[model samples]
Target: MKRIILASAFLSCASLSITSTAAPMDFDFSGTFTNDNDVVLLDFSVASDSTVTIFSSSWLSPDEGNGFDPILAIWDSSGNLIEEQDDGEVVGSTESNGVTYNHGTWDSYFTQFLVAGSYQASITQYDNFAVSTSLADGFERNGNPNFTFDENFGGATQALFNGVWDDSDPRTGAWEFHILNVDTASGPGPAPAPVPAPATLALFGLGLAGLGWRNRSKKA
Candidate 1:
């Protein structure tokens, strides 16, 4: 009986350890665009229902014609549009001779809490000359051009930019982004007690009973 109790205690400890050591659900990605009509696509999957927040940024500078405007869009697995953003906010700047050069116009930013499931995100350029309402529509209105520019860097799946260009071609650029999932219940309120397995509960009860019986024996 003593050996059986010891083994049960060991098993319970192992189970607790496994339950406590869960991997974090976060990811980071970066990519560069080579062609005027280049688009970067990222695919991600969520195991269970969760609130996922996504953020995106573009490389910007004060150098003439060095800044690239970026646009971000997300879609469900079925190709339905979820959300899109043209400019998030100014992320960087440079100061020279008491002058502050704001580069916010070129940088892009976006965030959204998504439900658990498979989803895809697309990053493309925000054409200064585009006339269409949305980037995706602009590409369709114009002739679908082949995205063939090679930016010398690779990570995301590339596709033709699906939007109208004010001019005849799309702009090229680079982007950095990340995703984070939040556990709202664990953030503020008291953490709920973990439910013990039936077998573990039974073993724990037996151990208590054993101690009670031993105490009675000593008293007698």
Candidate 2:
């Protein structure tokens, strides 16, 4: 009974040691914005085995030359720069008979690399005077291209995106943003627990035999 209890305790502790450290962390952001062509930046902590995804959505712009271009940068948990995409025009633009449209509902994923805890996302309108009219209609020069930009960093930290525009000026429009945090649950990978070797078992058996023999001699 005593040996059974000891073995059970050892197994329980080993299992607990493995299971206790198997928790998944997550973050998510989503939303829409109106005429404020500006930069949106986000920062998140990155673990050695962490994965991250960013989702972006926006209503189609009315202006013909206006399109949404987003740039992202990532830093490791230790404040080291890990990855960065610095293209004034990261998203490809589509045009139909001289009408241009940018990609919306964009998503980017990061994994299998070391990244810093901080991330920055910046957005800029391709054309200065473009405006969003509808989803299907490409950006057309309305009156003035006061594009809107908003952001949700999607982690423990929350940031508010605010840009200044002149309401009195017909060229400027209101910039509104909404950020949503999503679920972050990671499935365990194929890493299996290491089993004890035959050599270790043999050593344990020898130790047990020695202990038993010593106990018998003491009893005699």
In model 1, the runs with Cα more than 4 Å from the true position are 1-24, 61-67, 90-105, 128-172, 182-220
What C-alpha lDDT, on a 0 to 100 scale, does residue 49 get in candidate 2? 39
Best by TM-score: 1
lDDT of each: 0.37, 0.23
Candidate 1, position 32, lDDT? 48
Best by lDDT: 1
- Give the true-structure RMSD of model 1: 24.3
Candidate 2 lDDT by residue in tens digits, 1-111: 001000000111122122212332222222222433332323322323344433222222333122233323333323233443323222444432133334332211223
lDDT score for residue 147 of model 2: 25
Q: How accurate is candidate 2 locally (lDDT)?
A: 0.23
